[model samples]
Target: MDMIADFDLTAHNTFGLKSTADRAVLIDDAAMLPELAKASAETGRPLKILGGGSNVVLAERLDAIVAIMRIAGRSVNQQTTDATIVTAGAGENWHDFVVWTVDQGIAGLENLAGIPGTVGAAPIQNIGAYGAQLSDFFQSLTAYDLKTGTIETFDAEACRFAYRQSAFKSEPGRYVILTVTLALPRTWKAKRDYAGLDRLPEDATARAVLDHVVALRASKLPDWRVLGNAGSFFHNPVVSAEAARAFEDAPQYPQVDGTVKLSAGWLIEQSGLKGFRLGPAGTYDRHALVLVNHGGATARDIAALATHIRDKVRIRYGVDLVQEPIVL
Candidate 1:
């Protein structure tokens, strides 16, 4: 473990917010976690695990011992008649990992091609896109439990995955994910029900689906490197069937639980906040769902803009808008 005091974290997070940590510990190997845990315990400071920093809002200064996950490895764990089990180190880039699977002729993860974050962060947020979620292909994961100072494995059930939520997210800073395993189907099937993908042929190949999803995302969301934004800043609020009837103009998808998932983007656009700016933070003009940092923006700026968007949406639609990113 490599430790640096008063570490600059502006580059660590996608939002490009100016921030720093009292101490930043680089964890390039899983084995380093035990030693780091011991050091953290000795110092009496809790461990804060930071992955790719794609889905997080960082404060101006973090007073904790921030462990930057950089563990790296990937392998084909096992093969069964129906599926292929693969494993990736927690620090592996999520999009690159998805591309690797596709290059290997694996098909289940194609619909989730363009999501930003690390493999470990995927299960934490139950990351999803284009009608598919990480939970759909999950097998299990290895994590270092900070509370008990032991390594543990959690299956899908233990993960308790909901839309954009997981047990890790519910209990933040408790587990440091070391690796993620996914079970991809041997037989290929195209999932083309989502909007942009609906135009694809019923028998589209996994590569075709992946290419389309990537293109769609590229066209919609700005590159975080260029724009400094977290993609899809808010969750698509699920409302009761009766309550959804109030917004006839909003796009609504009926859920299995008899609720309706309304488009958060549509609501924001309807509320006239698209391309809206407040200080250095604003809503992206192209996609209202994304919140961007227009240079020199801080956590407080993003928070204020988020609060503004939420208040407007709630006032107009009587529905609450919850942020998707974890604020640290």
Candidate 2:
């Protein structure tokens, strides 16, 4: 692996903020991880692991040894009577992998279509869209432990999966994910519990679900290539039942555990920040949750816009809006 100095990260992040990494390297094989760890220790500089750069906000220059995970491979690891286990490298595009699984007749990942990011980052956030989360189909994952300099595997329970959280996220930069294995059901059933999906027929196929999800996401979220956004900028605030009662007319989805998941977009829109713009940074006109860089925007511009929205939402409602992207 060749190390590059002062690597420009403008194109590396979906936000398209212009920034530079002090040092960066790309590793295509897991065998090189030990050496990479050794080099990291020898350099005395902090190390930062990066994937497809979909879920990060590079507000400042990364002053560390940035190791871009590019390890790539995919295959059916096992096929049972009821399920199939498929493994993909960390660098594999998540949406592409989902499409591949559905095309192979595996049905568990259809509802997660059109999500942007790498396979390795999925479990980090326990990425969920529609009515499905990565934790639902996650079998296991292999990661390179920074402290031990050894490769380790973690099962679903070991991952400590929760809403938009996992052990990896709880302890960031501690492990470099190498591969992810998903358990897809052989006997398929469409998951149409989510709002738009509920309109589909009960016998809708995996392809049909995939098509609907793709179309739905396209209509809601701006394409990162065209608008430069990290999809949803904030998580849907889950509040107590009593607190949710105050906003009776607000769109609320009650959780199985009695908590109420209030729509962040609805909150922002209600706060009157929809289509709110300052400089080149602004919330997408179509979706208030999406903060976009409308060309010639600086990292500070986006940060300020986000802060403004958060303050307005917090003032209007008692709930604090938590940003979804990792600002680094």
Which portions of model 2 miss their true places by more than 4 Å?
none
Ten contiguous residues minimizing lDDT sum, candidate 1? 29-38
> Considering only N, C-alpha and C atoms within 3 Å, which residue pairs clash in candidate 2?
none
TM-score of each: 0.97, 0.96
Model 2 worst lDDT window (10 residues)? 58-67
Model 2: lDDT to the true structure: 0.89
Cα lDDT tens digits for candidate 1, 199-297: 999989899999999999999999999999989999999999999998898898999999999999999999999999999999999999999999989
**Cα deviation of 87 in candidate 1 (Å)?**
0.6
Tens digits of per-residue lDDT for model 2 on 139-196? 9999989988888999999999999989988788889899999888887789998889
